[model samples]
Target: MAKPKKISTLNQSIWPYLSPRHWPTWFGVGIAWLLAHLPWKLQRFLGKQVGRLIHKVSARRRNICLTNLQLCYPTMTQNEREQLTKKHFESMGMGFFEMLISWFFPVEHTAPRVTFSGEALLKETFEQGKGCVIIGGHFSSIDLCGGQMTRFVKVHPIYKLQSNPVLNWIMERQRERTFEKTIERSNMREVVKTLKDNCAVWYAVDQDYGRKASVFAPFFGVNCATIAHIGKVSRITDAPVLLYDYYRTETGYHISLQATPDGFPYLDDVENAVAMNKMMEKLINSKKEQYFWTHRRFKTQINEGDKDPY
Candidate 1:
C-alpha cells in the first residue's frame, strides 16, 4: 500500500517537531491523545486516580494547598482541610484531562455537553453594541468551558505564552482553532484592539501579582495582592466587564456570565480591587475544590516585612 501523505501547517514543517529531543514530548502528547479518546466517565476516573498519585508523592504541593485552605477556611478543622487538599489535587488531575479533552475531543460531540446558564445575559450585553471584558478566576475547568463557549459566542482568550516550543505550538494552534483568537496575557493593547472591534476578551484577576499594578484585597478571608486591571480596561474601552464562572454539572459542563456589581470601574483602585475579589470569592464559593488552590496566593504581603504564608 502507498504511504499516506503527512500533513503540516503552512507556517512550519512537522519535520522540526519530529527531532529526537522532541520525541519525549510527542510521546507524552500521544499518551494524552489516547486518554482523550477514553469514555468521559472513565477519563475522569483515571484523572482522579492520577491526582491521587500526585497528592501522595508531592508534599510541597500538598503543603501549598493546605496553607491556602488554612488561610481561607479558618473555621474548618485541620482534618477537613487535609481532606480538601487531597480533593483539590484530584481536581487538578481532572483539570489536565479537561484541557486535553478541550483540545482533542470532537467538538460536535462535546460542545453540546456545555450549558451556559446565563447565556441571555451574554446576548443582552452584546446587543448594546459595546465590547465585553469577561473577568474570571483560576478555575479548574476554565479552558474546558472556555473552549465550548466558542460554539455560542466568539470569545478571545488572554493566554500567557508557554516556554516549551512544542507545547506552545500545540496549545496556540488548538486555541486558535477553538477561540475567535488567543491574545497574549501581557498584550493589553491587542486585547483593547480586539474589544474596540466590539468583541469579547476573557481575563483573570485572582492570582497574586505583587504590589505593582495591584492592591491588597480580601480574597476569601485573607488580604492578598490583587490586580485591578479589569477595571482599567473597562474604563479604557468602555466595555462592560462581567464575571465569568465555570464548573461541572451532572448533565454537562456549566458556565455563567454574571453582571458586575453596579459602579464598577471605580476611580478608586482599592475599591475596584475589593469588588473584584468579592466577585471572584462568590464564584469560587460555589465549588471549593474546583478552584486552583495549590497556587501560592498569599506570597505577597501588604506590609514589606510580614512573614510569607507559603
Candidate 2:
C-alpha cells in the first residue's frame, strides 16, 4: 500500500478562511436553526448524542481535561474528576450548536431560549461614556454571553485566530455579525486605538501566552501562565475592569457581572490593574468546574534561561 500523506498544520491551511468570520457562522446558524425547529425532546436527544460523539473523537482533549482537572482540583477524587470531565464535554458540544443558531441566525429567533441577568452592567458601563474592559474565560456558551452584551454596548473582542482556514473564516464572520467590531491578536496597535475611542474591549485572558507575553499567576496555588496584556490594556486605557462569566443554568444561561472598586474608585495605574487581575484569577478559581478545563492552558513550560519572575 502507498504511504498516506500527513495533514498540514491548521495555521497554515485553515487560518485564511476565518478572517471574514460571517459566512461560516451563517453556515452553523443555518444548521442550528433547523435543529431548533425539531421537537424539543428530539433536539435534546440529538444534543446528547452529539456530546457522546465529541467524547469519543477528542480522546486526547479528554485526557488533557483530566490532567487539568486533577491539577486544579487536587482535593477531588479521580472518579469525581472523570465524571465532571464528561459532563463538561457534553455541555460544550450542546452549547456550541445552540450558540450557532442564537448568535448567527436571528436574535429574535434564538434569544428567547436563554435569558441574561447582568444586562445593567453593560448599560451602566456604556452610559459612563468611558470604555470598560469585560474579561471572561473559555467557558461553555462564552460567545453567547458576549453576544448578549452586544445588545447594549458595542463590544470589540480580541479573538485568537483559528488554525483551520475554512472554520476560522466561518467563525470570524459569525462573530462580526453580533459584535460591534472584531480584532485579531496580531494587531496590537489597533486594540489600543479601539480602547482609546472609549469603546469596550473584551479580552479572554484565560489561556497560555508562552513565556514572553505571560506571567506566572497563581491558579489553584500553582503558577499558571497568565497573559499580561489584559492588565496592560487596563493600565493604558484606564478602563474600568469587570469580571464576567456566563454559565448554564437549569432554566437558561445566568450571567454574573461584578463591578470592581466598589462602584467607583481610581484605577488609573499599572499597579491597580495588576491588583484587579489578581482578583479576576480568584473569581475564576471559585467556580473551577464551570471553566473550560480541557484547554492546554498550562502547556508553556518555563525554561532555565527565562528571566521573568512569577
Candidate 3:
C-alpha cells in the first residue's frame, strides 16, 4: 500500500448550545462516547440488545425494511423474510457501536480488526494519475469500514448534511480526524476538482432521492429511482471508478475493492444508473442482512399509478 497522506484538519469550534430539541442528540453522543471506551465484544453484545429493542418499537422503519425485503425477495417465504429483517436489525444495532468505535477510538486501535483485499486495484487506479472514485452501497458497517480504509489511503468522503447541526458538527469533527477531506454530497464542483487533482473520493450511491435528478432503473427487478450524476462526473473528471464493499465476518470485518466494468458511464445517463444499481445489487446480495434496508429504496415511481411501497 502507498503511504497514507497527512489528514488536513478542520476547525472544530461549532459546538451549539443545548436546547430542548438538541438534548437527544447530545445525549446520544454522550452515550456513544462512553460506549467507545468499552471492549469490542461487550459493545457488540450491547448493540445487539439495542437493535432488538429498536426492532420491537420502531414500527415505521421496521415496516419499510420488511417492505424492501418483500419486493427484493419475492420468492422467499414470509417466515424467511421476517427472519432476515430481524437479523438486519441486529446488524444495525451492532453498527451503532461500530460507528462509536470508528469516531472515538484511534485508527491504530481499530485497524487490527479490519482486513483488506484487492487493494492493488486501488493502488493501480491511483497510480494512473486521473484520480479514483470509490463507490459502495449503504451497508450497516459503512462508517467503520471507511475508517479502516483511511488507514491505508487518503480519501475524501461525500456526506449528506445531517438535519441536526450539533450532531453534524461532532460527526464532521470525527471524520476530519481520518479523511483527507469531507465534501458535501451536493458539492459537485468540489467532487470534480478533487478527482481532477488525483485524489480518491468515497461515495455511497444507494438511496431514494425522489423523482427529480434521478433515473428510473431496475433495482431488485423493480424500477426504482437511481442517481445519474456519477456518469456525468466521471465524464467530466475522466477518473476511474472503483467498487468497494465491506462486511462483517465471524472473526472481524473484510473489505474488498475492484475496478468497475471497462468503459462504464460511456453510455447514456440512464444506462449508467442501471449499471450502478446492478453493481450495488451484486454486493448487497453477498451480505443481505448487513445492507441498510430501513430506508425506502422503492419510494419513487415511474408513473402516477404506481403505489408507494412504504
TM-score of every candidate relative to the true structure: 0.92, 0.77, 0.92
Q: Between which residue pairs do clashes occur in model 3?
A: none
lDDT of 3 at 77: 98
Return whichever of 1 and 3 wins on lDDT.
Answer: 3
Write one digit per residue (lDDT tens) for candidate 3, span 137-249: 89989888888888766789998766557766777788878787889787898998899889988888889777777988899998998987888788888888888889988
Output the worst ten-in-a-row residue range by lDDT, candidate 3.
Answer: 4-13
Q: Ten residues in a row with the worst lDDT in model 2?
A: 4-13
lDDT of 2 at 118: 62
Candidate 1 lDDT, tens digit per residue, 54-107? 999999988999999989989999999998888888888988888898878645
**Per-residue lDDT value at 294 in model 1:** 88
After superposition, the stretches of candidate 1 with alpha carbons farther than 4 Å from their true spots are 1-15, 304-307
* Model 1 C-alpha RMSD to native: 5.9
Q: lDDT of all the models against the reference?
A: 0.83, 0.66, 0.84
Candidate numbers, best TM-score first, in rank order: 3, 1, 2
lDDT of 2 at 167: 49
In lDDT terms, which candidate is top?
A: 3
